[model samples]
Target: MDLLATQQCIKISQEIGWTEKRTIETTYEMKLFNDYLLVKKEKFPVTSIFDISFRKKSQTNDIGFLYLHTNSGVRTYFIKEEPFSLIEAYEKLKLERPELR
Candidate 1:
């Protein structure tokens, strides 16, 4: 994994009020969903990872969505939106990677 990218993600998560915790080794998958941003992570030995979604439903719907899943378990979380500009960055990335667009 890219340490710099991970750190940037961490910083963005922090800005959005996503609780940061110390854990063992883990992996992450991030993507965009509609106007929302999704971040998923799985720790070693875990069959499934936690899915976190962030979006602005309204001017006041700053809270985002979070989904946690294990082999036979699932959970959800509602969190405040982050301050980092995800949509802007996504647009920039799309422009840079036209083939992916």
Candidate 2:
């Protein structure tokens, strides 16, 4: 990530009370490897999430949607106008992992 994006992510993490442990950019800042994405937060176990979907949700701004399947259920996260970095990452992930499609 770039310096500005990294700063924004750090600010967001602080806003949400996250300690910023992982390098991967998830809702909870969990570590992610090529094989799997890790998610371990309060009220959540150390689970690996593979089911992920990204979509452009708004045309007015660089808004996007991230759908993730957790242990309990699927969750949706909205990416606000910030140049669509997450969407780009998702697209790259899709290219690397065809099974995600």
Candidate 3:
């Protein structure tokens, strides 16, 4: 896996939602292992940041990366690529993190 490319994809994913086209392009070479999409980078590699995965529920169509900023201790905004209803996304997140409820 290309580290630069994957980082770029992550940055973009954080800024905008991961569309079907972007997902295919970013994870084209990545191997799906269990729940995470595995990407191996060689140069300047600092572990995997995009290792987390999510399930697409029928209630939500909005898809994007969930970034947890450790340094700032704040949750970043969901970058949306295509137009989608965010209500379902919010519900899904709440369901995933029951503590937040």
Which candidate achieves the best TM-score against the true structure? 2
What do the candidate models score in CA lDDT, each in turn? 0.39, 0.45, 0.32
Which of candidates 2 and 3 is the stronger one according to lDDT? 2
- Model 1 TM-score, all chains together: 0.31
Per-candidate TM-score against the hidden true structure: 0.31, 0.35, 0.21
Question: Clashing residue pairs in candidate 3, if any?
Answer: 17-79, 17-80, 17-81
RMSD of each: 11.7, 10.1, 12.8
Tens-place lDDT digits, model 2, residues 37-88: 4334323222334455556655755546556666668876555444345335
Deviation in angstroms for 89 in model 3? 24
Residues 1-101 of candidate 3 have per-residue lDDT tens digits of 32211211222332345653443333222222222233344121122222233333344435455343222243332333421323343334446654435
Best-fitting candidate, scored by lDDT: 2
Model 1: per-residue Cα lDDT over 14-83, one tens digit each: 2223665543323244454333344555232221332323443555545454443434466544444452
Ranking by lDDT: 2, 1, 3
Q: Rank the candidates by TM-score, best first.
A: 2, 1, 3
